[model samples]
Target: MFDSVLVAVFTYNEENKISEVLEKMCKKFKNILVVDNNSQDNTLKRISNYPVKCIHHKYNLGKSNSMKTALDYARINNFEYLAFIDGDGQHSISDLEKICNKILDIKNGLVIGFREDLTNLNLKKRIGTKILNKIFTLLYKKKISDIQCGLRVFNISEKSIKWESSGLQHYFADAEITCNAIKNGCQISQIPIQTITSDKFKGMNILQGLYLLIMIVVWRVF
Candidate 1:
């Protein structure tokens, strides 16, 4: 699977945890790609010695753009699967094997790692996530446990399915991708995953949520 799959880690100022995360990933997968969004810290320097490919953005693009970069790379390189993990040390490396195994089993479905615990998040975030989840279910006709989960595995071989909002700066680009895939007749499934809570996990603000709501409605209608 390592030969056919590419593990992409998206990072932005994860100096404290990038080294350990990259080390763990390198140990498991031979082809690892780190898409860095111009980290202000020593994240790039820290991962410089690792046996992985690094793509540094000239500016600080958002997570969605970073994902598109990795997706394009994986597709061009002819990788059958693309696994995404965050570099903030929240997503567990132990779950990668399970995710990869699930991807192998599903073959062509979008496998998302569902984070079961929302107790660590604030009331606003939890409520917002719940509302967003409902909206996703209504729009995509698929029940998504965690639409914003950063840990996911995608089968890049489905070239016909394209991500509509890949260029969007909104946090809901993950939702957009999932919805697009589902609308394009792709099966979606979720696997329970363990996440390390952090204060840095502040999700979209009220304005962003409102914007995402508009995006969802527009996508639904059209």
Candidate 2:
């Protein structure tokens, strides 16, 4: 684990996956932060056993808000670098070592993951991702293979990283964050990441996926 790195995770009803994620995370990141979005299950209890710093939310504040909570906590606590991953068992802990090592070198930049494949992605998510990739490449003149990958590392300084989590309606938090970072002269690098697809997904459907796409297009055009 890197003493200079603090890893954060956003969780909601992730009781089944949080333990495994933490076990792996401890291998590369000494400090772990869990921001629970008011899970209705045993997620909080399960994560309580770990040495992680837990931040409980009474309500579901969405991913961007939860992530923002992690960032703010990291900044205030004096963490030099802040990295976050999904709580849905999609990120690989081994890849974190490489990403972190590289990011530490570029103290004031961003390091994001580029997925190797969408083996775990459902039909709607796969289609939406492809469309967003095209749009990002066109608009930003940068080839971003995975605009939604949860694995990313960035500096903790307020001036170095500015997040507008208020734009939660866009549902493209990763893309927007990266776009803003690049626009403000922060260097960005993409490292390859492995995908862990899930067999079951609750509440998310094709319609919600479509809404996300429309929102992204609207946000970009305007």
Candidate 3:
């Protein structure tokens, strides 16, 4: 069991998938947390069935806020590492396990489970990622294949990689973390993982992609 590691699952109306995710995670991990964004569905009730700590919001905070809440919980509870996995069934639990195992061997760093293939994703998602990848390479001088993958693990004690992404950039939080870590000269490792793509697992749209492109430059300079 990962005694010092906290696995946080963020959910919103994920009733259909939450129970399964919690069931698997609970069996594998001792310390698990679920941050629900006032899900109107049975997501909250589904989480209650598992033997994990849960925080239900009064209103629907964005996905990014749930991330902040999870990070705060990890910090307050003194967890050495925090791992994020979506409540939706898109992320691979095996990949998350790989990240946790990898982080344990690192002194301090961020571990991201980059998707191994993108042929099944939407065209916009593919194009958007390519543009962002180009800019990220130019600005950060690092070649990361997937900048917005949510299946990630990082040391909670390392403040340099703490991100300040807000608003609709909820989808861009992972990207911000990568850029911040690179700028601060922190260790970052990307492990290839399989992803299940679907409409429910929405990647950023045109506007969010454009905003993130601009913010990547802002984060690099200021």
Question: Is 2 or 3 the stronger prediction by lDDT?
Answer: 3
Q: 1-222, model 3: which lDDT tens digit per residue?
A: 888889999898998888888777877899999999889998888888889999988987778889999999999999999999999977877888899999998847899888878787788887787888888998889888787788989998887867777666777788888888899988888899986875574557788788899999999998
Among all windows of 10 consecutive residues in model 3, the one with the lowest summed lDDT is 195-204
Error of 1 at 73 (Å): 1.3
Among all windows of 10 consecutive residues in model 2, the one with the lowest summed lDDT is 163-172
| Worst lDDT 10-window in candidate 1 | 160-169
lDDT of 1 at 122: 78
In model 3, residue pairs whose N, Cα or C atoms come closer than 3 Å (at least 3 residues apart or on different chains), thus clashing, are none
Provide the TM-score for each candidate, comma-separated.
Answer: 0.92, 0.89, 0.95
Task: Report lDDT (Cα) of residue 98, candidate 2.
Answer: 73
- Cα deviation in Å at residue 59, candidate 3? 1.7
* Highest TM-score model number: 3
Candidate 1 Cα misplacement greater than 4 A, ranges: 164-168
lDDT of 2 by residue, 93-197 (tens): 887777888888777688889887875677777777788788777876778787667799887773646656443442457766766765567788899988777
Q: Which clashing pairs does model 2 show?
A: 120-197
How many angstroms is residue 23 displaced in model 1 relative to the true structure, after the best TM-score fit?
2.1
What's the CA RMSD of model 1 in angstroms? 1.8
TM-score of 1: 0.92
